[model samples]
Target: MNKVPITVITGMIGAGKTKISNRLIHGIKGSNCKVQVLVYYPDTITVVEDISTKRQYRKLPHQEQPAKLITTQEQLISEMISYSKEKQPIDELIIELAAGIPPQFFVEELFQSLEKDMLDKTFYIQSIVSVIDAQHFWFDYTSNHYVIYTNDNDRMEHTFAEVMISQIEFCSHIVINKCNFISKESLDETVSFIKKLQPKAQIIFSADGQVASQTFHSVNDVDLHQIKSNIGWKLELKNNSSTLNLVEKFGINSFIYESHSPIQLEKLEEWFRTFPSEILRSAGYLRTYSEAHGLELLYFSQVGASVIIETVDEHCTDTTARSKVVFFGFDLKDVEVTQQLNQCLMENNNINQTVV
Candidate 1:
């Protein structure tokens, strides 16, 4: 039976993964192959639109930025399954996750979803291909890599390199992308790095995502043993403080604030509404009204803020891990701003509680 091939494309924030994916998708579609690429964040769509417009305004410059669309990871995978069921002779389905996200999340969330659907069908994941950024080999990466954009400091650490390494560790193929941006010496260094990470990966050097079109001509049938051997079921993070290292690159003026104290919901909202310019991104588990009710995850990205609410299992003893928040951005090290936020958290006593 003919099967659909799914490739999970992962990399760092500015590591050129999206660009490569876009180019590949467009190039494949231009060919006889039915190809589709998926993105997981709306912000990425905006970036693509902006870049496309910029390129057009620049009279179609040397780099014709490809179109990118952002959809949820689960939604993308589900769509792929549905599309495959129709017996569409598609060549490739590339799913691009946001930078700094753990691959295990992709495996458990997207892969498992596909697997569950496959229980009644023959759809299966064919390969996992990771894209690496050659230029910024020494930088750090995190989920907040591009959430806060700063000027004058280019050496910021992002979880990109680590994510690339993780993708290589668990995938069948690794594409060392953006070689054109690196020198011969840097190119050698990058290859050396990948060799130590995943020595067995089919490494490819891509120029503008052009892979001779023969790369996707053959689809490797799922080798469960090989997949399991490449991907460790138990995902342990060896580098926890890499984010801290990344933030320190911007002059090391960063601190995380945590308090069990109740915050006046309105005041906290107001502060964020007028939050200072230096604050890049802030995320954490927070108790809304009382410690007894349960907690919610507070997420603040460039787009906006959201509170992901779920029933907190009370049996868990890790309170500090919950009932906590972290703020990272530029000029956040100001004594006045930190003191002001601390005072706000402390002073808000009687709040019209919104249980989130």
Candidate 2:
């Protein structure tokens, strides 16, 4: 049996993944190849349009292929396997993941299935396509809100910024949808930022998810290993490259803040309360010094209005374990910000000494 190619669509809650999937489905109307789409949403039902419906509300002579609604990962995999066994197997399959779920999680599952021979002869992942809302890209990307999902008695939550970054980092293609909603300058900046995030992915611009069908048809086979290691933060930290001169043209840049001294808990809290608006996203591991805990390692992350500092349970005494934080923002004053951070260090704090 011929293997069926699969394309996984991923994006945040208001991005245009559904619209893009609809467009893809419409393209298959006159083709000889059979196609199936599994729409996955944990919280609500998504109605995918049936393009095969006849005009004037009259029934069409041919059967309409409607998108199947899937609520769980197991169901998604089971449906794909079952579809492949049909008398007339589908030529291609599309899986539209929920906004709150990370693409990597599903990708990993698919790979595991392939290894265990569950999907090896039936289906293979062709590419990962991410949709972005051009108009609200910056705001949504930087926001600190959490994507929450509730199914009966089960509940789950994910950081909004983390989900946005993961979707961009893991995709093989990026669709910048709703282009007509933003100005030319804003669109350029949005593209520049995405390029920095995942420089390897091909970016396609569309006003209403009307991207060419050939765009999806001609995608190169994805290299899973490369995709896993293509994140911007990882590359930046590895190369020790502080700023991208090309991205600076749009007043957007990134830098790594590093220090060996421990940060005072009180000062760090104060800094977060008054975080600079220009610093859009910042995350790293840091060492904190408190009288009660002495020295401890903590994880720090600030995206838009959300700020998080939690214990990391790592040895802080190791000289090699320095505090390093990466900050990405617009028109950042690195030197000034560095000086301010220096003041928060334990070495710089004024401590009273009593001679006994």
Candidate 3:
């Protein structure tokens, strides 16, 4: 039996994954391929239009089908299995994972199912495409704000940088959408940064989400292990490198900051409020002192204008209390950032001296 190729579309919030999915549906229909889209949304309400009805209303040829809304993992898997068993199976399946929900989770699930022989032989993942917002990519990528998703009576939280980076790192293809909103120089820089992060992925720029159908059709099968371990940060961390040397190409640079002492809460807050614009992205773990919780281990994240310092949980058990953060930006001043962060450390009252 011929396997139905599945393409997963994902990106940060407002990056136009839905628009791209719709465009792909239209493009696939034009190519005379039967396609089905499954939209996994955190909320019950969805905006994926009934493209078939709209095409019929306009009397267009090869009317497309509507997208299915999926809210849980069980439902998504069941839907795919059912679709594969249909009398006239779809030529392609496009699963658009809503913004905020990491695409890795779904991709991992699909791989696990395939390994356990739970999925029909007629289904295979064709590509994992991440859509990026050209204009707001830097802003959204650097912000330290948390993305909260409530689904199936469970709440999940992840920093914007974490989610965005994961999406970029795990994908086989990247679509830089909304290119018209940014300058050519900015777009070039954005593309450069994405390449730095995911050098293996095929990248294409789009005015909106109008990518050629061939882009989707040309993708080769993704290697799950390579995609999982190829994250820029992971490579940098594994190499034990303190700095990246791309400052001349596009002024893109990165550095790792490490400290053993606890950060004073007041000073940390002050530092966050005055975070340098030069540092576009930073993420790691830190130890901080709070009046209510004394010495606590926390996760630190910063992207653009947003910053988040929150308690670490079981998921971060491997992370130590010692602070270690990876900072990425354009022409980052490692010394200046180091000094500022050092000043946020607690003072040793016993020795009447400040700890750095």
Candidate 4:
């Protein structure tokens, strides 16, 4: 069975992502191939126009801003698979991850999760063609222009350059969209900068989105083995004493608290809901019931940490029942914050162990 090809289109806000997306869809339709295509728009931000009147884009199931549904690549891929499984003659699928996601925010685990499936079918990244608003690139990606308006929490997240560099490093193609507004010198310099970040990415300049179809062709037919070969792991977690060091580097320090003790269900749920702002991501397998046939809670932050539950296998030992959760951004080494959370999560005992 030939697995369908899926392309993930991503970009920052107002970078003309929707425009290029429509163009690609039309281009694919015009080809008149007997190929089936499904485009998964970021379930967070709403795009007003419909390219296909007959087949309305199926909105991914979510309660928050629909765009939020495209929160992680794994969720996007999982939803795509679920959708494709129900369709007949499933030929190809195209998904847009959404606007304004920093490169680090792209989950490494999600891609790893798909490595197995990519081998079974034709899976390719196609291209992560970021549309550059020439006029705003310097403002958004170079200077601290947008920081003045955001709250204290977001102000510490990432610099403009870091975000742009992250996106460029991962994208397979560089689409300098809406280039009519930029000077020739600026365009050359921008291209030079992108090349420094990712020399392998093919570069294309488009005015009103007129890039050739070949721009998308390089990644059109990728082998799963090739993708799997590119897989490697780089998780940065400093020793418990390095909280200050982590803070200096990432503006965040994370602590993972693992306890085998069975937390009270109501207390656990309440703690998850009222989690502090300093935590960027927190997750673990939770065991609260007697038999260990309980639920798992995953916590992560886009704007703030979100908690969700799913079933897990029965755990036999409460003595070995551990909750390893990380709290990023809160000065964990600070006797005040880490101690407070230690008291909060443990609630009744003295559990003071550092990242070391």
Candidate 5:
């Protein structure tokens, strides 16, 4: 039918999610579709008067920030309703979620909360797409830390890693941007990483934030119940997206990997090199059995094709005595990953078993 297709763009903070949103907006200008955007803007960050001023790669028509960032769920629904009721028809609705919030919530809860007939008649979810930062995201993956700050997470309690991983786990398509900084070998490694994590998700490599025209095509409908966890919407009954509610469905499941003993560097790298494809993302801290060169802890975060490891100082507030990691993906076997990781732990500790 002729329902409006809504596309959501999500990713880690400063991961170029906004730039992708802008590209989509400008890309649809002359396509004969009436499109409107509702972007999330937290109160703390300074709002740019013209969000598109910096997008100078191509000549875009009058693209500007539609409204200040949307804060409350109520506001999001209210504004979207207004768009549907407007005199000029809007065939497409594009939403850009702030880094802290998961786009899964708005697409699942917001639509489900509204009258079924109203949503089916007016709006259908086109797709949920995530943008990843090539450099910073790699750093987050390797350093085992995401720069998601308190100001962003205040709206929700999800950690930066949780926020980023959820995006990778749930989205139908993943856009890895800012590839200019990495070498060809690193880029190949990055692609290999993502392919393992989400073999099903369409991977798009973009130097800039722009996607090819084909990626913007719309989907017919969004059936929540029948669709299952294809979009990683676990425990939709809850108002928020929490990993505690994660379940196995649509080929995806998550488990925590914890070890008391430190991991051997060579073994850990080997495990990473042989990471399972069914696993989409792994983020956590890795501790070496013995402190070396004043370094004891390494932060690790990997999504699909990117793996990042950041060295942690001894004085850091986070402990480096043990390795704690979280794994999320489709068709994953908890036993398999744990067993491989167990081989990486200090062989002498006698604590070879990893808690999953």
Candidate 6:
């Protein structure tokens, strides 16, 4: 049986992991390689559309980003591969995990369960990757997130920063996203900080979550248990230090604001012009009332003090007609931010009930 290479992508909630997954698979679509992509979101593993295929994308409403749910990992690796004697072959596979789930969980599980000769010989891990949000690295991560866990060994309180850095430490590659949003000097410091944590991992800077074709070929084995056995918190403390001081000294935090109400694009943009300076990054898909553009939804994202909103409904834009923007940084009172965002919402009677 020919071995199928698997690449595991993991990171924080908004670390560009999904975008990178789309790009990696899209880049390999036309190649001779036969590959399958599996994205493990919070609840289910979905087989997404081949965003590279224009025809498939055009079929979507407003040609918005195409996303499809897939069968579970058990189906692909065990049920399908175990019958390899009768099944057709798959050359490569990519698995993107849900936020907060570590990559090592899948790695250790596969090795333990795939011991049967059929799967043992056929399935192989290709690479592990973690995406980092460059602009928020300094002001959002650290403090209570890791400090709480460092003091108490409770995974329940594990911070996004802790989970994110662990993903980076265990992976073969680290992709620092939104590099263009920060100054070159700050980017250098971010890279240096990541280097101190994962010295051997390959670190790539990405302006928009795109990487070279060669990044997909790297396969590095990380011994998560071995690290746990030796040094332990001594090394783990470094991970906390990387982003802890920033959050502690700066006194900032992040949370997502999701509203099903359609927003007037013009009003939203106008508001962003004078939006609170505390917002480190705000990204989400929203509906626009403008009939001239014929666009039902638009994507808005602000990194640090800069906003990058696009009208294009390509695969890169994952925002829905409803908005779910993330606000990260300091001096943002929940009530004030919520009130300000509410003001940007459209006054129309139309309602999107997809919200909780």
Cα RMSDs, all models = 11.1, 6.9, 6.7, 13.0, 12.4, 17.7
- Each prediction's total of clashing residue pairs, residues at least 3 apart in sequence or on different chains, is 9, 0, 5, 13, 18, 4
lDDT of 5 at 245: 25
Model 5 whole-model lDDT (C-alpha atoms): 0.63
Model 5 Cα shift for residue 333 (angstroms): 15
Off by over 4 Å in 1: 42-73, 85-91, 119-122, 141-161, 216-218, 222-356
Off by over 4 Å in 2: 28-31, 44-64, 86-88, 114-117, 139-146, 151-162, 217-221, 243-248, 264-266, 287-299, 308-320, 348-356
Residues 137-197, model 5: lDDT tens digits: 5555534333333454472233455566667766677898988878876676666555434
Model 4 Cα shift for residue 322 (angstroms): 39
Tens-digit lDDT track for model 6 on 198-244? 55677788987787656858444345455433221224332332221
| 1-356: candidate 4 lDDT, tens digit per residue | 55555555566555666566566656665665323333333334232222332123233332111232344455666665664464644444545544445433443444455675563354444445556656466555534422111333443334444445456656656788878878886766556544434456567788866665445755354433432222111022212222333423224444545555545555555666765665433434444442244323332222234354544434423223454443444344544544444443533332222211
* lDDT winner: 3
> Residue 258 error for model 1, in Å?
38
List model 1 lDDT by residue over 1-356, tens digit each. Answer: 56666666676555566666666666776776777666665332222112322221212222233334655655565666567665654556676766655455565566566667662244456666677766554443222222222235533232333344456666667777768977887677557545534556688887555554346434564454464444311111112121232222233233445556654455666676676665533444454555454434343222123223344455423543424444444445555555665655633434334332
How do these models rank on TM-score, best leading?
Answer: 2, 3, 5, 6, 1, 4
Winner on TM-score (2 vs 4): 2
Better structure of 3 and 5 per TM-score: 3
Model 6 lDDT at residue 303? 43
- Better model by TM-score, 5 or 6? 5
Quote model 2's TM-score. 0.79
User: What local lDDT score does residue 121 receive in model 3, on the 0 to 100 scale?
Assistant: 68
Models 1 onward score TM values of 0.49, 0.79, 0.72, 0.48, 0.57, 0.52
lDDT of 1 at 269: 63
Better of 2 and 5 by lDDT: 2
The residue-level lDDT of candidate 4 at 218 comes to 54
